[model samples]
Target: MHAKPSYTEAQLIELLKLKNQRAYNYLYDNYSAAIYGVICKVVGDEDEAADVMQEAFIRIWRNIEQYNADKGRLFTWMLNVARNLAIDYIRSAQSRKSSKTESLTESTPLGAPGYTDAIKIDHVGLNAVLDKLTVEQKKIIDMAYFQGYTQEEIAEELDMPLGTVKTRARAALMKLKHLFV
Candidate 1:
């Protein structure tokens, strides 16, 4: 097997700063598959993962100047962008799914993708507030929201009493409301 050409991270950064097409090509060739794998794992949708991969690259290109070598490696910065985009995609997709379910039986025509018009809270900030909750509260909320688990399923999976699960979930939501609103 032939050996692959190697470029140092600093060199790649310099090339990227100059908007070199070859540099962009090299970056994608080396990292796109790995980044896409991460997106797929988080979003669980191949199409959405592909979209997030493209968006992450666009963001990297646009924000190249914002990267700080003193802070960490170039790959670290790229990974952070990819992860954040994937999380945002998952959250947005879930909210859309819920809204669609809610509007399905209404006599009036469903509004055209009104998710963007819904309450606009910063996801990272919300996650921070969630971090402040008790571990059990946080776990239930994550199961219910991120994993799309029903209360019954959560109770069964956690081996907790159904009423206790319901109570904790309600308490978690109330805490989130206070933290977010």
Candidate 2:
């Protein structure tokens, strides 16, 4: 087996900016798992997450020149891209339509051929993290992150000002950040 190529973040950035195919391949090999994790957290389904993952890499490749090292690290920018794509996927009209159809098809008649009871699986880590937040913060985080609601959508759905929603989300994330560090 061939050894994997390694590049320092700076080297990788330079190579990516040059549009080197090898650099792109190396970037994908090294970073796809972390990127996929972020996508999965937002997208929440294996199949859909896979689709968004491909789109995210394409976006990263095509938009590599737009990345500003002064703003943040490469991974952070990529995560934001993947996260935004996932949010867009969930918010899309097609996704909404599919979700509705999926729900209808997922339900089986009582005593039918392929009937199964609904499972209640607790996301312990998510719950623990959420428990640290206030009721207002929790509502915003739940809707924005787990339920895949955009901040604007959350504000509208909650009848809150968009600025207020943004403030709450920022504060909530800050608190969660403190918990880990």
Candidate 3:
């Protein structure tokens, strides 16, 4: 759906190899949007996508010298750079977010005598919303979020398919999001 480049790509690459600023400018002018599009698709957040795009460009600029025509076009190489950076950024963000959430959960304790759980305040906040959620949703939410069970664990424990568990979890979250927001 995109138009072909007006400039010969090989010429741009040759100039790029020589470290020409104009060639870099031309490359950005012609391909920044496409690269950003790829990043946005992976990150699914505009602000984070912008950050990933900036990092991707920095990586491409530094690694341009390693690109070879025999492997593929300069454009493809640059596209890979952007996509990989975006995916890595997303994964790292998820890791950090999960760690923080676990830490918070660990600090919470179930007040029952001789019964200690990582969750402290889950009972207070989640109880109000439980009535609003479907049976399946409530079960999934309890296992995954409250009871600290993984998707695979839920599926195996309940004797259901993993895909079904995931789909149900997603639907449950959507329902809760609609209810709360």
Candidate 4:
């Protein structure tokens, strides 16, 4: 097989901005696995993850001109796109309805092999960082960041006041900051 093409980030961004198909192909070839991994973590279902992955790529291709190198790297932007799509997918009414069925199907019969997700938070030490927070703090951070819930949405979903949600989110962030430091 021919060696895959490689381009520096700058060169790839330039080519992508120029709408070069080869550059798009290279970006997908190199980054799809990482993007899919993020999507899988957010969606937790392989079929839905694959669907979200397609939507993410389409979004990236359509919005390539909107990407600003001054803000962040290409992969980071693409990851956010994929991750947001996955979160959105999970929050959709269709996903909620299907999840009811999926949950039932997901359970293994007795003696069946256990299934593990493709991505593990502990592998990247996110679990360790999260473990430092209280349950209430962790719930706020997980819903706000990982699950892509707005503070208002989280409040409504959890039946808590918006102020309480905001307070917990801020406290969670403060605790997380200490962990990084």
Candidate 5:
């Protein structure tokens, strides 16, 4: 059996306030295994528990300043964060699973009218405006919004610097906004 940790909750809180790595590591050493066990109990997978455990600690570290002695105990706050993260992860996995099932099985026709019909563009006018844009701008905007590529992903895919990709995307969006307005 391992020896019990010597640091008091107040001492650990002070170390955390100072952003001391040793204090953080000590907290992790003392608490992470227990937290991971709780997460595994909820999530039923070691991998998911590990991931949620990391996320929980990250959130705890980031929000250390928000912790209050008067509100509750430190361990209580930490456990709450862990449990919440595990629950959120499970819910997100379920949502993704349902979305995949819907996508695979649903049979919405191509000509189906979605709710945004009032905002729908005339194909000819939309094509004309799109033709006015530079190819680089068009490609970046299409990938970023329509295809859901993040700015960094777009930059890496296009072999361009990340800042250039962001600037071009913003400019393209501005141009599109002006056209729509």
Candidate 6:
């Protein structure tokens, strides 16, 4: 296996700012799998996740100049970019599903093959475990995981400090992990 190149965050930022192709190649080699996994978990489909991940990389490249170290690490910013795109995809899908349901209800041929209520078996267990979490834990976990809100966005919505959001998110993750494992 080829080893990935490591660069300090500052060095990475400088390289990316200069539009160094090597830096971009290093980034994809190292981070694409992690980003793809996150997108897949959020979108719950490999195909859609791949689509979102591609768009996210484009966005990250396009917005490299806007990154600020004082705000957070570059990876965190990139993760948010990927996550926000995934969440946007989810929202857009939900909107389309709702619209489709409306149209289907209005006029659909009798005995349609794809006209049944499908059960999302994965979510049943997830919701059960989520119910066991504390209110704070559940809120933070839901907004971040299911809703794909960034830590900064969560803090802004909850009016809490970024550190506190991180702490709660960590706690919530541990709690959920314990329940599942």
The best candidate in terms of TM-score: 4
- Clashes in each model (backbone N, CA, C under 3 Å)? 0, 0, 3, 0, 0, 0
**Could you give candidate 4's per-residue lDDT for residues 1-181 as a string of tens digits?**
7678889999999999999999999999889988886676567667877888999999999999999999999998999988888777776844657653343224212211222443465344755764677877766665665567687877876689999888888888988888876
The better candidate by TM-score, 3 or 6, is 6
TM-score for each candidate, following the candidate numbering = 0.54, 0.67, 0.52, 0.69, 0.51, 0.60
The collision pairs in model 1 are none
Candidate 5 segments exceeding 4 Å error: 1-5, 98-181
Model 6 whole-model lDDT (C-alpha atoms): 0.76
Over the stretch 69-136, how does candidate 5's per-residue lDDT look in tens digits?
A: 89999998888788778766765775767652242123122222222222245446656786777777
Native-vs-model 3 lDDT? 0.71
Reference-based lDDT, residue 116, model 1: 32
**Residue-by-residue lDDT tens digits, candidate 6, 1-181:** 7566789889989999999988999899878877886676567667878899999999999999899999998998999899889888876886767653343223222222231322356346645775678777877775666466688878977799999999989989998778877
Q: In candidate 2, residue 131 scores what lDDT?
A: 72
Candidate 5 overall Cα lDDT vs. reference? 0.71
Q: What is the C-alpha RMSD of each candidate to the true structure, in Å?
A: 13.8, 7.2, 14.4, 5.4, 16.7, 10.2
lDDT of each: 0.72, 0.72, 0.71, 0.75, 0.71, 0.76
The top-ranked prediction according to lDDT is 6
Q: Write the per-residue lDDT of candidate 1 for residues 1-181, one digit (tens) a residue.
A: 5455578999999999999888898899998866875566556557777888899999999999899999999997898788778767766775867652332222112221222322246345544774678877877865554345577878877799999998999999898888867
Candidate 1 TM-score, true structure as reference: 0.54
Candidate with the larger TM-score of 1 and 5 = 1
* Model 3 Cα lDDT, one tens digit per residue, 28-136: 8888877876676556566887898889988888887899999998898998888778766755775777752353234223322222231456445555676678766
| Better candidate by lDDT, 1 or 3 | 1
Model 1: how far residue 106 lies from native, Å:
27
Off by over 4 Å in 1: 1-5, 99-181
Selected candidate, larger TM-score, 1 vs 4: 4
